[model samples]
Target: MRIEIIAVGTELLLGQIANTNAQWISKELAHYGANIYHHSVVGDNLPRVVEAFEQSRKRSDVVIVSGGLGPTEDDLTREAACEVFEDELLEHSPTMNKIIDFFKKNNRQMTMNNRKQSHVLKTAMVLENSEGMAPGQIVEADDSTFIFLPGVPAEMKSLMNDFVFKYLTEKYQLETKIKSEMLRFIGIGESTLEEKLKDLISKQTNPTIAPLAGEGDVAIRLTASGKNPEREIADMKTSILERVGHYYFGSDSITIEEAVQDLLVQKSLTVGSAESLTGGKFIERIIQLTGASSICQGGLVAYTPEAKQRVIRVPKEIITRHGTISSKCAEEMAVQAQKLLHVDIAISFTGVAGPSSSEGHEPGLVYIGIKVKDAPAEVFHYYFDGSRDKIRQRTVNKGFELLFHKLK
Candidate 1:
C-alpha cells in the first residue's frame, strides 16, 4: 500500500527539534511491504495541516500524521483532522480515565485543559496510548485511511506496534512477505562495488540489489518478496553472496568490530594500536564491543613526532630522514607498539588528513602498518579524497581492514 507521512510541529521548521518520528515510521512501514511515497512537514497551523491531509488523501492509501497531539493550545492535529473529514469531536471515556489515572499516579492536579487530550473524531477508532496521555486515532474515509499519532516518539512507537500494525495486517489481508539482507563491505568504494556487480543488478527481479554508502564502508541490501519469508530471504542472500562474497565482511546488523572480536577470540590473539592521524579511533571502536578486554591489550595515540619518538620509541633518525607520514615510520610504530604492549598483533596508522600537504606529501595520504609474529611488518600506502574527518575515518577503517585480512 502507498503511504505518506506528515510531521506536524512548528519546532521542526524552526530547527529546534528534529523530525525523527517520520524516519522511524518510514523504516518500520517498509518492513510490512508498504511503499512510502512522500513526506510532508507542516506547522501547527490548522489550515496548512488540512491542506496537507487533502493532498495526501488523493494520492496515498494511508496517511500517517505525527505530532501536535498534546493538551496545549498549539496542539491542533485532531482539530485539523476533524476539519478535513468534516466530523465532530467527541470525548472517549477510556482515554479520559487513562489520562486521569496518569495525573493521579504522578501526584499532579488535572486541569480542564487536560480534557482536550481525550478528544477524538466521532467516526474514528481510538488507539490506546499506554505510554502517554494523548491517545491516537484511526479513521477510514472514502477508501483512504488516516492515522493520527502523538508527537512523542515513545507513544507513537507503542501505538504503531500494539495496534496499527495488527489492524492494517487484518484490514488489508496482505499475503506476500517482504525480506531483506544487508551485506557489509570494507576496503571498497560504493561506486567500485556497484560497477563490479552491475550485471547482476541490471537483471534483478524478485531479488533486487541496492548499494548504500556509509561512514568508511558500503552496505549492499538484497530484498525479496514471497509467501514464505524464510525461503525468500535465503534465496536472496545466496544470490548476493555468490556475486559479492569476496568483498563481504559480515551480514545484517553485524559490524566490523564484532567480526574482529570474533576473529580474535577464535585465534586467541591480543591486539594493540599506535595511531597518528586516526587519533586512536580504531582502538576506541574495538573496546566499545563487549569482551574487548579479553583481546585488547592497550593503545597509544602518537599524534606528534615527539610523541611517536617518546611514547612508541620510533627512532629519531628515521623520523628526521623519512618524516612522520612515511611508510617506514608506520612500520616502526607498529613494531614498537607490539613489543611495548606484548600483544600478538599490533597495527599503526600515520597519515596527513587535512586540507594541506605535510612533509611534501599531499592530503589524504595514509600509511597503515601491521605487525605479526613470524611475518615481517608490512605497511600499505593509499591516497584518498574527502574532507579531513572523512580521511581520518577512512584511514581508521583501512587499519582494521588490513589487520582483519592479515590475521585471517
Candidate 2:
C-alpha cells in the first residue's frame, strides 16, 4: 500500500515541537510492510489541507493524517473530510457522551465548542479514542481510505494500535510483517562498531543491518520481513555478535545499567559507590531500577577531599600525595567505600569534568576505581570530551560497562 502521512498544525510549522507523530506512525506502519512514499506537514488552513488531501488521494491508496482534531476553531480535520469525500457531518452521540462524562468526572464544565470534537463523517467508521476527547475516523471514498486521527501523539498511537493496524491488515490481507532485533553495545564508538561489522552489514540480504549511535552507547538494528521474523532476526544477530560479543552488552531496549543490575543479581553480589565527578550519579542510575534496593547498599557523594576522607574514609595521605583527581585517590575511595558501606563491591569516580581544568589536570580527565571483595583494587584512567553533563553521563556508563565485564 502506498501510504502518506500528513501532519496538521500551525504549531508544527512554527517549530513549537517536533512532528513526532509522523516518525512514530511511519515506524509502526512499516511493521505491516507499508510503502510510505511521502510525509507532509500542513498548517491549520482549510483550503490547503483539503488541497493536500485531494493531491494525496490521486497517488496514495492510504492517507493517514494526524493533528487538528480538537475543540478549538483550528480543529478542521472533520471539516476537511466532509469537503474532500463529499460527505455530510453527522453527530456521534457515543463520542459526545464519553466527552461529557469525562468533563463530569473531572469536575469541569463542557464548553459548547467541545461538541465540535463529537462529530464524524457520515459514511465513516469511527476510530474511537479511549484516551482523549476527540474521536478518530476512517472514511472510505472512491476506492481510497482516508484515516483521520487526532494530532495528539498518545491519542493517535492508541487508535492506530488498537484499530487501524488490525483494519489495515485484515483489509489488505497482509502476510509479511517487519521484525527487528536491536543489539546494544557500550565502551565502543559507532565508527569502531561499524568497522567491526562492516562485512556483515555490507553483504546482508534477508535481514538488513543498520547502525545507530546514542550517548555512551551504540546499537545495530537487524530488521527483516518474513514469517517467523523474530527468529530470523535473532539468528542474524547471533552471527553478528559472535565476532564482537565482548562489546555487545545487551539487546532489544535493555539499558547498560539494567545489564549491570542483572549481572549483580545473578552473582548475588551487593554494590556501593563513592563519587566525586558524578556526585552519586552511578549509584542513582543503579537504584532507579527495580530490585536495586536488594543489591545496592548505598553511595556517598564525596565531592570535596574532606568529604572523601570523612564520609567514605579515603585516607588523607593518598589525597595529599597523589591529589584528589589521581588514580591513587580513586582506588582509596573504592577500597574505603567497600569497607564503609560493607558491600561486596565498591566503585569510585574521580575526575576533572568541567569547562576548565582543576589541580593542573585538564577537563575530561577521569579515573574509575573498582574494589571487589577479597580482591585487589584497581583504577582505570580515561579522557572524554563534552559538556559537564556528557562527561558525567559517560563516567556512569563506563562504570557500569567495566563492572559488567569484571563480574563476567
Candidate 3:
C-alpha cells in the first residue's frame, strides 16, 4: 500500500522540534510492505492541513498523521480530519472515562479542555491510548484509510504497535512480512563500499540492498519480503554475508562499542585508553555500555602535553621531539598507558583536531595507537576533514576500529 505521513506542528517547521515521528512511522510501516511516497509537514493551520490531506489522498491509499492532538485550542487534528471525511464529532464515553480515570489516578484536576480529547469522529474507530489522555483514531473514507495519532512519541508508538499495526495486518491479510538486516561497516567510505558491492546490488531482486552513510560509518540494509519471516531473514543474511562478510561488523541495533565490549568479555581482556584530541570519548562510549568495569581498566584524558607527561607518563623528551601529534608519540602514549593502567590492551589517540595547525601538523591529522601483550605497538594515521568535534569523533571511531582489527 502507498502511504503518506503528515506531521502537523508549527514547532517542527520552525526547527524547535525535529519531525522524528515521520521517520519512525515510515520505518514501521515499511515492515508491512507499505511504500511511503511523501512526507509533509504542515503547521497547526486548518486550511493548510486540509489541503495536505487532499493532496495525500490523491496518491496514497493510507494517510497517517501525527501531532496537534492535545487538550488545547491549537490542537486541530481531530477537527481537520472530521472536515476531510465529512463526519461529525461525538464524545466517546469509554475514552472519556479513561481520560477522567487517568487524571483521578494521578490526583490531578481535569479541566474543561481535557474533555475535548474524548471527541472522536462518528465514522472513526477509536484506538485506545493507554499511555496518554488523547486516543488515536482510524477511519476509512473514499476507500482510503486515515489513522490519526498523538504527537507525543510514546503514545503514538504504543498505539501504532498495539492497535494500528495489527488492525492493518489483519485487514489487508498481508501474506508477505518484510524483514530487514543492517550490516554495519567502518574503516571504509560509503562510496567505496558501494563500489565493492555494486554487482550484488545491481542484480538484486527479492532482497533489496540499500546503502546509508553515517558519521564515520556505512550501513547496508538488506530487505526481503516473504510469507515466512524466518526464511526471508535467513536468505537476506546469507546473501549479504556472502557479499560483505569481511567489512560487516554487527546487525541492526548492535553498536560498535557493544561489539567491542563483547569481544573484550570473550577474550577476558581489560582495556585502557590515553586520549588526546578525542578527550576520553573512547572510554566514555565504552563505559556507557553496562559492565564496563569488568573490561575497562581505566582511561586518561591526556589533552595537553603536561597531562600526557604527568598522567600517562609519556616521556618529556618524546613529547618535545614528536610534539604530541606524531605516530611515535601515539605509540609511546599507548605503551605508557598499558604500563600505568596494567590492562591487557591499551589504545591511544593523538591528533590535531582543530581549525588551525598544531605542532607543524595540519588540522584533522590523527594517529591511533594500539599496544597488546607480546606484540609491538602499532600506530595508524588518518587525515579527516571536518570541524574539531567531527575530527575527534572520527579519531574515536578509528581507535575502536583499529582495536577491533587487532583483537581479531
Global lDDT of each candidate: 0.88, 0.90, 0.87
Q: How many backbone clashes does candidate 3 have?
A: 0
The top-ranked prediction according to TM-score is 1
lDDT computed for candidate 2: 0.90
Better of 1 and 3 by TM-score: 1
Alpha-carbon runs more than 4 Å astray in model 1 = 97-109
| Index of the highest-lDDT prediction | 2
lDDT for each residue of candidate 2 in 1-408, tens digit (9 for 90 to 100): 788999999999999989999999988887887768999999999999999999999999999999888989988878887888888987899998998898999999889999989888889998789889888899887868999999888999999999999999998888888877888988788999889889888898878899999888899988888767788888888888787888888888899889888888999999999999998899989889999998999998989889888887878888888999998999988998898899999999999899888999999999999999989999999998999999998888889889988988
- Give TM per candidate: 0.91, 0.86, 0.87
Worst 10 residues of 1 by lDDT: 225-234
What order do you get sorting by lDDT, best first?
2, 1, 3
Every model: Cα RMSD to truth: 2.4, 3.5, 3.1
Task: Give the range where candidate 2 is weakest over 10 consecutive residues by summed lDDT.
Answer: 225-234
Name model 3 segments beyond 4 Å from true: 18-35, 69-71, 91-115, 126-135, 153-163
Per-residue lDDT for 309-328 in model 1, tens only?
Answer: 99999999999999999989
How many clashes in each candidate?
Answer: 0, 1, 0
